[model samples]
Target: MNLTQSEIDLDLGAVTMSCTTDEVATVFAGLLREMRSAAPFIRPDERDALRQIMSHESGALTAGEVFPDFARGSDAHTTLRKLRTAQFIRPAGRDCWDTGEHIEIRPFARIVWDRLGEAGVFGDPPELEEDDIDLALPGADEPVEVALPAPAKARGTRSGAKWDEGDVLDFLNDEDTQG
Candidate 1:
């Protein structure tokens, strides 16, 4: 198949949507306002514990291991219970817990980390140098000539040889064709 720059007709105008930063902020604010007022709140300590678990190579640890400050009886249980109720962490096996339902926390955290980078939380995103934007797109007026290989021939049962009625019977009787 051959195609040119001008031959490709796309309805990008209808498909594309754009908004100003202020408009995006306003919409996000409205969404936040619309959320339930009594949503569960995660404490800073719980966040720290989650980060600790995520930082661990296996993402599994005892509450005591995560929060050495607190004794492992009631206080640690309380914290783990709260996080479990919030569906953040759960029991891994005996004497240990992990992010609930064996969910991978690091990949999800990496996505958020990338979004934070894009939001300029770490620092201003690196400015694109001239070399980065030097590639030129072909204009619609310019001809884009493409040479495509001829369409492939229809294949047959024996490599490229088409089978007749006798050939089918011979193929079925041949021991080489048996499974």
Candidate 2:
């Protein structure tokens, strides 16, 4: 079944998840895990932005090498502002925001697109009748939304703290052992 935003919100609340830093961090870590599973490693800037994106559940495209889209802001601040107003993400630091429990990148984007399509953001499509074979297609007729790549900001270019592919893999596997 297609889960609506309201339904997602209710589910998050019911599950007792916090809309705070630790909660956001955990969710981001999870998304990173997914990315890592698919690839050797994620770029440092991408990791940071992905954390923000996942935390805020911002439907706005994320800027980075991995997920690129035209709908996102040119800078991190502007992106944060838009995300904050929408209540999708909250500020966690000077450059970070807590994505409320309700947001998940893929699912949230689908919901946003569905809502926007309903609101006529992209204009209307031809009406489909019951007999139209296209109506039974696996995916929705609406266009899939993609997160825009993050602009080449100075912060992203800064070196030293960036984690490479191997570093990320090691970090993920590192489970602190108690003596």
Q: Pick by lDDT: which candidate is best?
A: 1
Assess candidate 1 and give its TM-score to the true structure. 0.30
- Candidate 2 local lDDT, 54-94, one digit each (tens): 54434443343223432334454454444344333444333
**What is candidate 1's lDDT per residue for 85-113, written digit by digit as tens?**
54344555554433232322333233433
**Model 2 residue 78 distance off true place after TM-score fit, in angstroms:** 1.7
For all candidates, what are the clash counts?
0, 12
Report how far residue 52 has shifted in candidate 1, in Å. Answer: 1.0
Off by over 4 Å in 2: 1-63, 66-74, 88-110, 118-179
Which ten-residue region of model 1 has the weakest summed lDDT? 147-156
Give the Å shift of residue 148 in candidate 2. 48
Q: Cα miss at 69, model 2 (Å)?
A: 14
Candidate-wise lDDT, in order: 0.46, 0.41
